[model samples]
Target: MSSSTVKTIQDTLKAWKSLVFPTFKVNDLLYFFLKAGLAVSTFALVSLFFYLSLSHPSFNSSSGYDYKTFKHLVQQRTIADASAGAEPTNVSHILFGIGGSAQTWNTRRHYTELWWKPNVTRGYVWLESEPPEKENWPETSLPYKVSANTSSFKYTCWYGSRSAIRIARIVKESFELGLDNVRWFVMGDDDTVFFTDNLVTVLAKYDHNQMYYIGGNSESVEQNVIHSYTMAYGGGGFAISYPLAAELVKILDGCIDRYSHFYGSDQRIQGCISEIGVQVTEEPGFHQVDIRGSPYGLLAGHPVAPLVSLHHLDYVEPIFPNMTREDSVKKLVITYKTDPGRILQQSYCYDLRRNWSVSVSWGYSVQLYPSLMTAKKLETAFRTFQTWRTWSNDPFTFNTRPMSENPCERPLVFFLDRVESVDGGETRGSYVRYVDVSQKECDREEYVPALAVQYVNVSASHFLSDLWKKAPRRQCCEVINGGDGVDSAVYVKIRSCQASESLTPP
Candidate 1:
């Protein structure tokens, strides 16, 4: 090695020694360890916080699965074990099995479309066959499914159509679809108009996990006698809980054969459910509309329960006068959208100064009697409709007052005209007087003042959905402003009755 290279190597070694073995004080070492400990402790605490957040029952996750969903799925157990199901029942949870046939669906689809909110509502309209090749299926309507052949099933009821067998199987096919999150199976005719929000309100009252057969019987006593009064009249629509549906589908095909002599599909279903030992849980909102004429009397004095479904619409007069059946239903739907929980709800109060009794059927009509009437008499429906089969006036599910021949004896009727939402969750509905040319006007001085009133304005708070969770009670109304005998409009307010309030004459 050259002497110059050896000198350079020696200098490099001395410099490297100085850099590697640089001196450190005791305080410096202690500070370094302290920082390291703090970092490790901080990391441990952060990890623990994250773990606790994920594990907590009340914690909600926006990123992926929720706590209840995760626990229900991963742990394979129900949330709290006391919940109605995994969650509150919604439109999606109730699977509607609409019984329709190719022959009638074309016309009946109009009724189905009026209430069917596409995408938001779940289920199919089960038809006997594909619709006509010439007509294309509209995306706006519910998707159609051809029902499985039921020709092999025994159906021997001489008066009943064989179609009842096919319709009864809709429940079976709907269950077989294996849709997720279904808690209730609701069956309705294609022509039946369902107030879906109110239907949910009704269904949510019961536990979906339990076996329940929930529906209403026919309004006509004769029809109820012909069919089983214990059975739910299917056209009014009926809800079967998921637990009940699970059991029903298992024996439905055999049940059909067992009940071959039954006259209606609803009767057949009732028979099958009877075998399972579930009784009909009657809800007043389901109306079979087994009346032959106007349904005005029936709806005006609706039961305290929310209106759920109305069936046999084609057999009755249009709900509103001077409108087609479709238009009348649509009109009611408009008002219904304004206040679903209040539709067909009857509220009445007396105008003592004016000597008038006012009955308000929220979102439907108002009846202003010129003279004071007892609450009991006002609550009873007028006999504007007749028995479904024989058109007799004698029998109905509810008490009815016979229409007085004298025009002065009856109250002046007003029909809903317009409804709009107000600030602070209130609704304002205006009703116009409904006058028939065939009806004679009373010339009595007592009737003159009431007849002069052309408009009825109703104000009410938007109904709370949770109110149905509590006991059902008829709400009360007050005449906020009876006209000064000059203005043609009168203002009424519908409100929840106070704890001590009662409808007694002052």
Candidate 2:
């Protein structure tokens, strides 16, 4: 009785234990499934939130709801009910800060010619050195107003080092003088000159009302620099719109004591802007080409067809030693001198434009070709153009059908009649040869005596007269060409030559 009873009791106890505790395997499986479901739900919720915020107009940043005050303003003005005809005020202004060494001062003149002259009305110039003791200074005969303001620091060790202090003073004074109309602040070295004629017009087209900052397209700033979440590269030529500028000033004013120890002005500015949670607009065409060891191209973006500006920081004196008051007053225009031979062979043109009115001699020439080639002659030309045309480097390129694409065949004639022959000695038999990229081979022949031809060949595919017609007329050298290849392709060539003796009327 005891043995049988003991076995039954033991089996009963085991069964009871199994029912109460359950299997370890089952518990583990259940726990895993529960956690997986929770994780999936959490992820889905987060994704849904982001998606809703991104796609729906109510949640979009462009919608006023993204910011509290912006929303209130829009509501109060009944902007939501307004028609499309309502135009918002464009609140962008160009602010330029000028200071530094004699070279820096000279650079300012070029900036004046390129940027200030064409675009902006107000700017600040901080004199690094006392203006040749007022008594010894030359009489003020320039067209633009030149004011000499003293700096707290007598001598700045380097341009970058002193930029912050100079900028601080200029910014503060600009704000105090009720000059709040400025929406963008452009800070750069003095020697910068714009190569392009249409930079201001282009910028005006794109300056939207936002906290944006544009910089020169250079790797140096991108890699080595830490920009504010909202701003970057205060040097070279950089622009910060009004709202950003105002916000930056507020942050700087509040945190000046904390960031005072930072040596780099750009770093300090970036740090402060980032701390405030602003976003930076990495734009092309703002640069500090004057910086030592910088790239040959514009730092901010692609090159423009016309130059915006160039930093003449290095050769400021020798280049403009004889610059006169009259030169400053005269309206300067750039005329491109092209060698057609270079255009056909290299699919590029060696072109140079110089302002005869100014004594400034240091200028850059460009070689431009089609955009399709790997050699990137057009890219180089555009970059060079932007470097001088805009305060920064930016190339404005648009795609269109090339002259070679046309079905009709016509002879491309490059007329040299408008060119004033620099070579006085007249030799009759000399002729110039040019390669025609529009044709498969350079077999086509067109001849004009050396005396009659000023420099190079024009592709039959292109008409110099057409280019001249579209170009700004003043005084220019006309190149004329006609041919079957002219239907689909366009070409530019570069040539080495002395300055032209005469410029044709447009």
Candidate 2 structure, TM-score to reference: 0.44
User: How well does model 2 score by local distance difference test?
Assistant: 0.37
Candidate that scores best on lDDT: 1
Query: Which candidate number would show the highest TM-score if scored against the true structure?
Result: 1
- Assess candidate 1 and give its lDDT: 0.84
Model 1: clashing residue pairs? none
Off by over 4 Å in 1: 1-85, 133-135, 483-486
* Model 1 poorest ten-residue lDDT run: 72-81
Q: What's the lDDT for all of these models?
A: 0.84, 0.37
- Model 2 residue 387 lDDT score: 23
State the displacement of the C-alpha of residue 432, model 1, in Å, after optimal TM-score superposition: 0.6
